[model samples]
Target: MQPLADRLRPRTLDEVAGQQHLIGASGVLRKIVESGVIPNMVFYGPPGIGKTTVANIISQVTSRRLYRLNGTTASIGDVKAIVDELDTFLTPDGALLYLDEIQYFNKKQQQTLLSHMENGKLTLIASTTENPYFYIYPAVLSRLTVFEFKPLKKEDVESVVLRAFDTLRGESGESFVLEQGVAGYLAAACAGDVRKAVGAAELAWLTCPPEDGQRRITLAACEAVAQRSSMRYDRDGDSHFDLLSALHKSIRGSDPDAAVHYLARLLLADDLPSVCRRLLAIASEDVGLAWPQAVSIVKSCVDSALQLGMPEARLPLTEAALLLATAPKSNSALMAIERAIADIQAGRIGDVPDHLKDGHYAGAEKLGHAVGYRYPHDFEHHYTPQQYLPDELKGAHYYDYGPNKFEQANKNYWDEIKKKHR
Candidate 1:
């Protein structure tokens, strides 16, 4: 039997669950599809996000010969067979091939399509759940334009679930009772995968018990079908880094609640190392010299998290997040280093002052190394103003006092000392 998802697969761009940026009116993809000249394109994104559906829509609108291949099983021989069909009367106008999971194809397999693509014998629309640039052969990837398909929103998934429900009802010719919020529950549980949402709705309906001569689709039934909320996280994909960014930004923004929420999401995805690393970085990058001790405290929390692992680890990780979010935030250190590095990169690195060079070596003092170097410790208040920066970067200020109590206090102390000494 055709699965409900396949049966209800969108026949037009308008019916696709998400990715309006690509297929909506005024979208570049819509313009391309309507132009009747399809190029070799790669659809990049997670599964159940309408890559195949968009490819199908393109095929329908262009009235081109359509061929489908799964990278998991399609061999070079299969590709050769398709190539051999190019000259046949059936595909005189060239063929449109939809290659799903293109990342699974080996380099050689990917290269096999290059000649056809180069000569306009075939227009390829390949899709992959992984980052295509990382997986596709450079030669093959260079020739294909890439478009990203994002996950469906909750409302979009709910719409799909309700549509499937309506279809099932029409097919069964029976009045089914759908409990309030059941559709939304299934939609949220599917984690933006429309295919999963539809399948769960079908399962819920199939397993639903008939009460009073009607199969009541209840929230409990939907939950049973969904099993558990699926996390939209992939260690190698964008979601992983996106969640990490969310956590970092939340902590930097001083929202402990949001910080913990994002932290929980990462932990639920079993991304302990990523969270720990980001937290450690946040200590120095965001908290910086404002709360110098924050680095040590976060480090301890990270250590405890690594040793504890998972369920127990979440506790330390949570503590670390709370500490960071509530701590005084500053990026002065980060800005200082970045500015210095930018100067170095731009060829602003003048020779180190002779006074700052290694003077402990024999003959170094004779060579003017450390010749004029003043021992600040020998001066009053252990202070001396001397040339430290390179000649090219004289008087350049890198470090800025951050606007925090700790930094401001230290800044005031240094200001007084420098004022008296100079």
Candidate 2:
């Protein structure tokens, strides 16, 4: 018997659960299919969304025989066999080739399809759970129109779950009634994955015991099958980077709630090192010199986290996140370094001023190293103004004081000392 997910596979665009943006009455894809000229395209998004279903529908609408291949196992030979069929009387005009998880295909394998796509021997619809721009070679990527399939909404999942339950009930030849809210519960628990929701509904129906001569599918049964809400995270994929980016941005934006929320999500995936590394970077890159001690404090938190390990590690990490969110924010240090690098890259580098050059070496005096240098400790307030930057960068300011208490205080002290020197 086929899995419920496979049994429920949508055979037409109208049967697909979501992706109204692509298959709705006015959707771009719908218009393309109606025009009877389906071009090569790539579907990019998470799984259990309707990429394959839509591709299948496009093949049917365009009256082309569909050939499905999984990139994980399909070899160059498999593709060639399909190409061989193009010359057959049965597939005279051409055929649609559906490649799933296309990212798994190596560059050479991906390239092999280019000639076929260009010659119209194959109309390609490739799908990936990754960003194609990063995985697909430009030669192949440039040939396909890319469409992004978003996760199904809760209501859409609920509708699909109810439909699956009805199908299961009829197929089993048993009387079963879904408890109120069972579909909605499964929908929310599945986290916008229509296939998962359908599977859960099928499981709930099978595991449910008959009461009063009819089986009752309850929310509890659905919960047991669904378990924890599905989380779309791959440590090596965009989900990993996307969550890390969210956590960092939340901290940088000064929202402790959002910061901790994303942190918990990453930690739940057991990605301790990534979360720790990102937090440490946030301390210096985002908090920066505004609270110079932030680096040290975050470092200690990270060290303790590494030693304590997960669950417990979350404690110190949480503290670190809260502290960073509450701390004064600054990017002046980050911007300062960036500006300096830009100058160097643009050939603005000048010879080191003689007074700032290394003078401890023998023969340095002959080269005028450290000449005319003023020792600040020999003056009042340990302060003296002298040329420190390269001669070409004289009077150039790379760092402007960030509008924070600690920075402003340091800025005031330096300003006063320079005023006294003047």
Candidate 3:
């Protein structure tokens, strides 16, 4: 049996669901189709947003001989064979070559397409979930325009549900009445993914028992089959933004347990890279100089993830999250830099004192550069109050050390130095 997604696959641009930004009137794609001019391009986005479907539609609309290949399995020889076949079918006429998961193609395999794209022999339309700018070859990327397809919206998912339910009804002869909440429940579970929504609807049908040979699909029935409570976390909506906000706040609030909990949820849902990146920001933004080690630890987790990948790599992330949550919290460093930026933008610029200016440049000595600069090592405690900040910020204090052992000791040491210098 054909999968629900496959059965309802869009045969034309009109039937295609979602990605109104790309297919709407006056959209780049719509314009291209209308003008009968298709360019070599890359569709960079997440899974199941119609990259393949769009490619197929373009071929049909343009009446071009389309050759589709999976980048993961196709070899250089296979690509060459297709190119040879394409040559015979053309006399200055163009063809569309669709490559799925283009990132799976290593640099050597990618090089095979550079000449073809450059010479305008084929209109290459490639799709990749990974960032093509990082994964694709520079030469190949340079020859293609990149279009980003955003995840489908909830409304789009709902539209798909309505269509699927209608189709099911037609086939089953009203055997099932799709309850009002059933459509909403399935749509939410799909998470801005039309494919998943269709799959959930099919599951609901299979699980519901026939009433007089007519099955009635309800919210509970869908939930039982899908094994998901609700689709409240719309990947492309406000809930998505809200989850990230809560995750950041949970860390900043200094609850290690809560931090770990949120981190676990995100990781379990496969948002590790984003979690790692956000932790890096939190280290400097929330922990700052209060615990300088936090930044390095977060960075280490990121590197570790890149090295070990998933499942095994989650340990480093867990360690980093716990360290950040327990670390002394302060926004002093974040604030201080922001204040400095404001000063600069407000044109409160001050001249560099002669002693602090670079002495390695020509005629620096005559210019009084490095004139009165004192070596802190020459003094006891390796401390000196020689001016470092500009005059406007000379006595301004930024970091107020927290109650942590290391910060306390450093604070005492700096306090004694300030007294001696005064």
Per lDDT, the best of the predicted structures is 1
**Whole-model lDDT, candidate 2?**
0.90
Q: What stretches of model 2 exceed 4 Å from their correct place?
A: 87-90, 179-181
TM-scores across all candidates?
0.87, 0.94, 0.66
lDDT of 3 by residue, 1-422 (tens): 79988989998888888877888876888788778878888898767778888888887766667788898898988788767765664624756789999988989888887777777777789998777888888899988889888878778888898888778778777656777788877777666677788888887887787888788888887887666433434454444555677778988998888888777767766676678788899999998877787788789888998689788778998888888888888887777778778878888768787798899988999989989999889988887778887786677564566666666788898898789878
Q: Which stretches of candidate 3 lie over 4 Å from their true place?
A: 90-92, 228-264, 270-281, 290-422
Compared with the true structure, what per-residue lDDT tens digits does model 2 show for residues 248-320?
A: 9999999999999999999888999998999999999999988999999999999999999988999999999
Ranked by lDDT, top first: 1, 2, 3
Cα lDDT for residue 258, candidate 1:
97
**Preferred candidate (lDDT higher): 1 or 3:** 1
lDDT of 1 by residue, 146-249 (tens): 99888888999999999998999888876798889998899899889988889999999899866766788989888888976567788988789888999999
In model 1, which regions exceed 4 Å deviation? 88-90, 106-108, 133-143, 172-175, 211-213, 343-354, 357-372, 390-396, 420-422
After superposition on all C-alphas, the RMSD of every candidate to the true structure, in Å, is 2.9, 2.0, 9.3
- Residue 397 local lDDT, model 1: 89
Where does candidate 1 clash, by residue pair? none
Give the range of the ten consecutive residues with the poorest summed lDDT in model 1: 55-64
How far in Å is the alpha carbon of 364 misplaced in model 3? 31
Error of 2 at 43 (Å): 0.6
Model 3 scores a C-alpha lDDT of 0.79
